[model samples]
Target: MRRLLRLTFRYLFLALLAWVLLSLLLVVPLKWINPPITMVMIDRWINNSSEDFKLRQTWLSWDEIPTHATLAVVASEDQLFPFHRGFDMNAIQQALRERERRGQLRGASTISQQVARNLYLWTSRSWIRKAIEAWFTLLIELTWSKQRILEVYLNIAEWGPGVFGIEEASLHHFGRPAAQLTPMQAALLASTLPSPLRYDPANPANHLRNRANWNLEQQRRLGGAQWLAPLNER
Candidate 1:
């Protein structure tokens, strides 16, 4: 009985040690190295049986993606990205209250949490996925700077079927490069994030146009692109 208990404890310790070391290995290089692919991208590839399915991604250096797209997403998705760590407690609380009132869950994921999920986890909502997402979120918040997190998020976000990153979305949707994305164009792309498959940046509906216009207003309210200056490395 004692020997069995000792072996169980030893195995548990080894497993934990491996997990910690592995997380460091994964999170550290992402500060400088772009991920070649993300788990969700892989998931999409596996599920899509169409011959037309192609992963539309073109990795660009941070400078290659225009500041307009970055701030636009920040305005549309997570207005508090520059200030918060991994989690947004107020947003979470608000979501919980809304859920209680409406009997339906609402997403309160901050950009950092979305980054963690996009890179490491699946899209399915469950207690287990949320727990793992929380774990990755902490490890990332501890290891990566805010700039690195946003860079990864912009690159890996799925804009449409097979469309990933601002660069690809720009070329595919707007016939331009990411660097040349105008404010309105950037806002349009940001608006598609919530339901990329349903919304087309190339041919936006009336609702999408309204959302894009709203995003631009929010971008201005957040002090324009200058709001991101602190995250920029001097």
Candidate 2:
């Protein structure tokens, strides 16, 4: 019986190894190439179960997306993105402290972490899911440049229920292309990213408006798009 149990464990380990290797093969190419679809898109489609339901996403290269959008997200979601590898230890500690004090968990996910989730994982919050996300985050940080990670994150992040990417989001919300978004317009979009369905960028609630203002201030404080200089591939 001990031998039988050992054999079962061996096969299970092999199966897990094979799964990770297969995923690496599939996911590594996305460093240079845009993914045709993400798991979230598929999940949303399945839940809707309607033929008329369409997922909106437009792939734009890193340069095509305006600097305002990048700065806004960095300021709003991950202020230490440029300095951190995949995880921000300081932010995590702060978030933990805040959770203890407030009795509510607030977001501390970095852009790299978000890219890992948006690219390779699902939305649910679980310890198992977080472990997988950390593995993929490490893989991505090693395999892809910071700019590539941000580009993929920007493009794959869900702007609304069916809407994905800034290009689609800009057109859907502001009636303009992403290239033309002003600082305020871009900040508003970034502010909605936390809960896109709950907060509409076109018609921002008071909370969202306040957050947008905060993002704009943070963007200015962080030296705006100039900080993105480090992200550019040499």
Candidate 3:
């Protein structure tokens, strides 16, 4: 019995060590190199399982991506992205309180957390998945800068059915490259992010148009492109 327990403990420790090393290998190089594919894209592909289903994404360097696109996502999704390390405690608390009040769950995932899950993990809502997501989120926050985090998020985010990344989304909706996306066009794209599979940016329904307008207002209030200057600092 004692020998069996010792062997079990040794195997568990080795497993943990391997997991850590593998995660480091996956994350550290991403600081400089772009990911060729992410977990979310794979999941979507497997689930669709149809010839019409396609995964579209284009790799744009940070310079090729425009400020409007970044600002739009920041305004629509996470305003405290530049300030938060990995998680947003305030937003989490608010989400908890709202769940208590409304008896409904809502997400408070920061851009870092989204990047972690989309890049590495499957789309599941188990506590184990959340815990793993938290681990990856911490690793990303520690390994990459704020600018890199947002850049990865923009590149990996699902904008529409089979469309991933700002470049494809821009061209699909507006017939323009991501670099030429105007503020309104960017906001329209960002507005679909919360429900990209459902909302169509090109032919926006009334609610989507309203949400895009609100994002534009929020972007203005957040000091526009200048607000992102801090992300470039380090």
Cα deviation at 17, candidate 1, in Å, is 1.6
Instruction: Kindly provide the TM-score of model 3 when superposed on the true structure, using C-alpha atoms.
Output: 0.93
- Candidate 1 structure quality by residue, lDDT tens digits, 128-149: 8888888889998888888888
Candidate 1 Cα outliers beyond 4 Å, as residue runs? 1-4
For residue 73, give model 3's deviation from the true position in Å: 0.3
**Where does candidate 3 stray beyond 4 Å?**
1-5, 98-104
lDDT value, residue 143 of candidate 2: 88
Candidate 2 residue-wise lDDT, 136-157, digit = tens:
8888888889899889888988
lDDT (Cα, 0-100) at 53 in candidate 3: 84
lDDT of each: 0.88, 0.86, 0.90
Candidate 1 residue-wise lDDT at 91: 91
TM-score of each: 0.93, 0.90, 0.93
Q: What shift in Å separates residue 200 of candidate 3 from its native position after superposition?
A: 1.1
lDDT of 2: 0.86
Give per-residue CA lDDT, model 3, range 1-234, as digits (tens).
Answer: 999999999999999999999999999899999999999899999999689888899988888889988999989888888888899999889988998999876788988999999999988666688789999999999999988998889998998778899999999889999988888889999998767889888899999999999999998899989999989875
Best by lDDT: 3
Q: Which stretches of candidate 2 lie over 4 Å from their true place?
A: 1-13, 49-51, 97-106
